[model samples]
Target: MKTLDFIKLDEKSVAPVVESLKQLLADFQVYYTNLRGFHWNIKGHGFFILHEKFESMYNDAAEKVDEIAERILQLGGAPDNRFSEYLKIAKVKEVDSIACSDEAMSNIMQTISLLIEEERAVLDKASEAGDEVTVAMMSDFLVEQEKLVWMLVAFQSGKCHK
Candidate 1:
């Protein structure tokens, strides 16, 4: 039987979707690791805020990682769990260290922008395939990420959200 036969989606139609999601999963893995490192190594002014923010972002990323992996399984694809694969496939490059608050937030914004682009591509594929579940997931991700971009911009401008 075709891999997606049970789900009623043409495997051919969903194949690219699955591949795109696997790439997204790899990106999220790298993003999660980078956030963790930023949280630990953030220094200088606004350290408290950036540190807390990085921790929160990384925590969110961890949840997203799981969600992406589960989605891949739901779509009849194996979730690639190897970091080596992530390094090879992810567009979001890993940072060695971000010592400045501004630079760290900038890095985050750049990464989020990349993710937004990726999620939009996934959204389009899922929409074309009539995969409402994946479409909704991508929609939700886009909403949250767009808001994050705005908020991060404000934060970088030295404006506190509260």
Candidate 2:
């Protein structure tokens, strides 16, 4: 007998989607850690502004971590919860504490670029698997992250200044 999740997605089709989601979960965890470090340690001219922004970002990341883990469980897969597992599978590495706001922003841009790539892959995989829920979630993430990436690039390039 073929096993199906509550949503009627078969385990066979859901397996690949779940795997991709797990990888995303791991990446989000690492990114969250880096953002927390940036929030606590950021300095220089934009210290207050950057610190607040990092806090907002990490808070959003924390919510995303929960959503990804829950989605894995909804698909009948165990979410990889260990830091060790995350470290092994995550492409986004743990960054050392960054005190420089510019450097931290640069790192954030790089991390977002990597995330956009990974999320697109997952979006494709989920679409292929007929997992509409995951597909929708990834699409939403991509839109938001894409905007953030655009804004960061503009800020970094001094294009944001009049």
Candidate 3:
């Protein structure tokens, strides 16, 4: 038997919250992957600026993904990584096409909006479940994600254009 320190929850009580965390992890992975794709493939007159910005965003997302997976593991749950698993669990969409600069910005803005919503929901669930560790982890992620969303929204809205 694999010996483990499992934080016991009232499974019946927290089952829905646990399920939501699983879904959140899947969504976070998809968003992280998409951010990396944007970092690698972004091209245009503003390629240099957008490329660097996307790289930073993706790096931050990568860290958050690791943190989320670790939290799931700590909760005695296996983090989902299979494509089918992600497809079913994720609330975030994996865009199937590469877009032009304007479209890319719009896509990122939309994605960030969804991400922010998901993060807030997760935070609330974590708190309600009395999972303080998960709540704190999500709070950290929420702040960073909120900042990234604002940055992306500003760029998309031409507020960053000069």
lDDT of 2 by residue, 1-162 (tens): 323544788788788889999999999999999999999998888788788889999999999999999989888889988999999999999999799978899889899999989899989988888989899999999888988888777767775455
- The estimated TM-scores of all candidates read 0.93, 0.93, 0.82
lDDT of each model, Cα atoms only? Answer: 0.88, 0.89, 0.72
The TM-score ranking, best first, is 2, 1, 3
Q: Pick the winner on lDDT between candidates 1 and 3.
A: 1
User: Model 1 misses residue 110 by how many Å?
Assistant: 0.6
Taking all chains together, the TM-score of candidate 2 against the true structure is: 0.93
Per-residue lDDT for 8-93 in model 3, tens only?
Answer: 55445455556667777787788777777777777777889988887877787778777877766666567876878888868778
**Candidate 2 lowest-lDDT run of ten:** 1-10
Quote the lDDT for 145 in model 2. Answer: 92
